[model samples]
Target: MDVDDYIGGGSGGGGEALIGMKTVEAPDDGSNCLICLDGGGGGGEKTTTEAWVETPCAHRFHSRCLESWAQVKLGTCPMCRRELTAAAAAATTTAGEDVHVLVADPMVADPLLARWNLFVQRSTDGSRSMSSLVRVLAVSHVLPDEVAAGGAWPPPPPHVVELSFLDNLQVSKAAIQRLFFYDGGSLPPFESVVRSLQSSLAAVLAVFLPLAGKLAYLPEPGDVVIDYSPDAVSPGVKFVEAEYSGSVDDMRRLASDDEHHTEAFLQLVPELEVSMLPAPLLAVQVTRPRDDHAGGGGGAVAVGVAIHHGVADGQSVWQFIKAWAAAARGGSPAGQGLVKLSRVAADVIKGQRTRTFLLRADQIRSLKRRISRRIAAGEPPRETASPVTAYVAIASLVWTSVVRAKPHDAADEAYLMVTADCRRRLRPPIDPGYFGNCVAACYARANVGTLRRGGGDNGGDDEGLARAAAAIGAAIREQLEDPLGGDIEGWLQFHLSLPAARLTAVGSSHRFMAYETDLGWGAPSRVELVSPFARELVMLLGAAGGGVQVSVSLDEAHMDAFETSWFQTAAGDVTV
Candidate 1:
């Protein structure tokens, strides 16, 4: 039914309004009356000609049956048992001229109902709006058993990494999203999957408790903390159960397609709903295809996870995912490790488009060979250089190709920012399973002319690739030697000072086994990094098959040039 149909006109409208109860004509669709399971024909016979009345909560009943139900001195609907009178009176008073009632009909496919439900579910802080494409079924906080048992839960000291500018910069950005798709053929019922995910998430959150806490800035002490105090309200991770209108294939296509449909992918995940301090550090959404049940359990299901970048880096996030999956399968979660910190900031750009490019294993090997040949011949290498891994080679190729794609002056400096996991590089070394952000950003720079030196559009510029690789290798080596050194406080300012047009930031290493995250039904057919906040950002992930899946965002024109250069370089014709 249309939403306007539920809005009553002034005092005397479509139906009578009793103290707290308002009754309207029921929809003509042959829906059974809640009071009496007859077809709105009271208890006599199943007929569609009988008159029916709808309560404020949208429960419809035969007029006579409802009158009989009211005679029993019950002021509630027979089906849902909601107070019928109070809801109608509040709606009448709040809407003034029109009595606005929320009409929820299972038979009707109404976006208004979906919007209303979403608003009510996430209205805790009143900062989030309703999403039309994704309907929220339920929203609940999953707290660790220790904290939920009711006692003072002490807050941990803020890690220096968490307070650093790098982490602080991510406070206002969108949560990092990773979508995992699975075939539902062998899986249990959809409800069972959701239950397992929630229960296991709680089990896993006990070990990684910080993820369940909030990122709060204490004004008195002038420090930020992962708050989990007993006094805090809803001190737990937000778990959302949602249903996506699109099919599983739709999401798969969006993930694999060269052209990115970001908005569609964003709808699959729950928003973190960050305002100021005390915002949720993590939120998880499990979405089942609308037709999953209709297909008798062969449809696909997607698990979409959103974690605040300030709370955890890629390694920590994946570790949590794998742990949650293991717990879901009745296995014990990985043991908890020590926690630590540091930060950087960036702004979102407009008119940018994202595209994914695949580099086959053979192509990667060929590119590495070409770079090796250049280094062996006459090109000089950095003094303290690291071996040219596939990442180094691919990053260099992308950096050089992008520089050639955009318009830049010959002497203009083009910068490449690469992030490295600092777990092993830190003093005393942090455990690999340690929770929280432990990543440091390293930078490489070269003149525009030097990046585009080969002078041809063929994209076979081995010399340029060699030079770019050397610069990146040196940057990584220098940054790892002292991950926390060199003007750490000014890191954000330094990056902000760089020209956005000439910067290319790389995120998410291929070593983080994303596809290996299995939630019982088998490994994910595909994994996608849906959100790259910066326009010049690039994300590299290990594909389900071999090789790396590179997702890059750039302006329309620049992306076109980059695609041409990229395809020519990594296409089947890679020279060894």
Candidate 2:
């Protein structure tokens, strides 16, 4: 449905006016404190000494407790290290009138979430968050030449991202109504909202919901009620109710349409007024695929989101999902989001909980080791000097494997794409602590069969793909473990300082392989990891319990064999 239709087509100006006022100080004695309530403290003395200080992200912690836990290493919040102090964050706030946004969920208008819905009754406290599911960004690389030369792989500049939530049909209509309508208005602080979005990007997966029998927990994308407001103060917060059409196909087409969907998405960006890249967390989309026709090759609904990596990673996003799910299902201890992940300088001796300099020192040591080993072995010159990422390497390997798997199909070429995590790459980053999808696509590809499978001209065993994947993974791990001198700013400066000719030759798009198909119903019908945008080759791979999920585009005849062979390789029986 178009934005207007999804928002019920009317001006939606008459609903109860919900204003964004300064957050009230939470109740002490662990009543309003998520951590203290969740028992995050080490217990005994730790519990007594710690009092939760509400953060801009809506998360509560003991004053100076988390901040002083780790001295160095990822000194920033484990949630992505964004500063939280009011002074350091003042510039990001936009002051103005409010826009009439939509409150998608009218069924539960209480606004306040119940505290009981926060914890996972079946799992540990640390495991309840959604930040664990996925991490890894898919960035769309603008090839240097494409930007400099123009028109080769021409497409309109990418438009705004459209995020939608998928609701669960099995949920009883009465239950949905209770969760949406009867809940009280205990919405988290704006700071918690931002941090939650970052958590989603970190691959945390959890869902939140509100209901009558149960207290109002945080809400996830799938809950019956969804709300939207302008990120900045220029527009007043508006809530719209979305009519569930009950079809994901409809949602996908509407979301991807450049004209209608893109326009609505763009309208929301400026309101966010993010100082760095417009790393707004767009919107949360909830999708559920059922097993109506199990064993049949039927498609499943998967929620697609575009988050700037400057926010969070896959792990954090997964955490958010779990939380949301617990809330939606009426789990206990609801509404409490995950604690902030950062080093605390005050918690440890010398004002350090973790070794701040360990990672850097390790990196230096590794580099020295590499140099010595290279000199001793007299290795050949390397092809690329920059670091590599796991997604890049895996993508390369998958691309090469695809070409090798099908030798006869030389006429049609394959494209390579990589999903880039823009959380850190973007300018003024999103709330570093939020948990949600914050990734973009990046890729590289070549005509595998034609170029190397001995079809017409080039003829060689494709060795580079495997090597590339390994190399990319190593490079990315290195960076994550040790990091570079400066952040994205330094990287941008270095790039801009390079020679113009060099800049002009930069390549953006590459082949990519993604494993996103989650079949709660059963195995995926068919999973092809194709990029929404254009690129050389795209491979989609999902995972089931016993075997890995895979999708590829090749000669129709060869697809069957590839599938059979893959299962054989993946399902190798144990041997003594």
lDDT of 2 by residue, 1-576 (tens): 121211211111133221111223334332222311222321121223443443334444343323321111111222233433323224333345221222223233211111111211111123325422211122121111222233332222221112211011111101100000010123233233223333332222211111000111122321221111112211211111122222334433433331222221211111111112111232332222222112123322333332222222443434443443333333422244423222100111111110000012222233233333332332212333233332343344344434455543455434433444444744455455534334432223344443232111023222343333433444344444422224543433333222211011111212211222221222223222111111112322222222222223333444444434332222222110
Q: Model 2 segments beyond 4 Å from truth?
A: 1-310, 330-338, 341-393, 398-462, 484-490, 493-542, 546-576
Please write out the lDDT profile of model 1 over residues 388-505, one tens digit for every residue: 8999988987898899898888888888999998888877876556666678889998778877765232445577777888889888888899987886425643654456567889
Give stretches of model 1 more than 4 Å off: 1-131, 146-166, 233-235, 294-296, 336-349, 381-385, 453-461, 489-493, 573-576
Candidate 1 minimal-lDDT segment of 10 residues: 104-113
Note the Cα lDDT for every prediction shown: 0.64, 0.27
- Could you list the CA RMSD of all candidates, in the order they appear? 19.2, 24.7
The global Cα lDDT (0 to 1) of model 1 is 0.64
- Candidate 1: pairs in clash: 20-85, 21-85, 161-341, 161-342, 162-342, 165-343, 165-344, 166-343, 166-344, 167-343
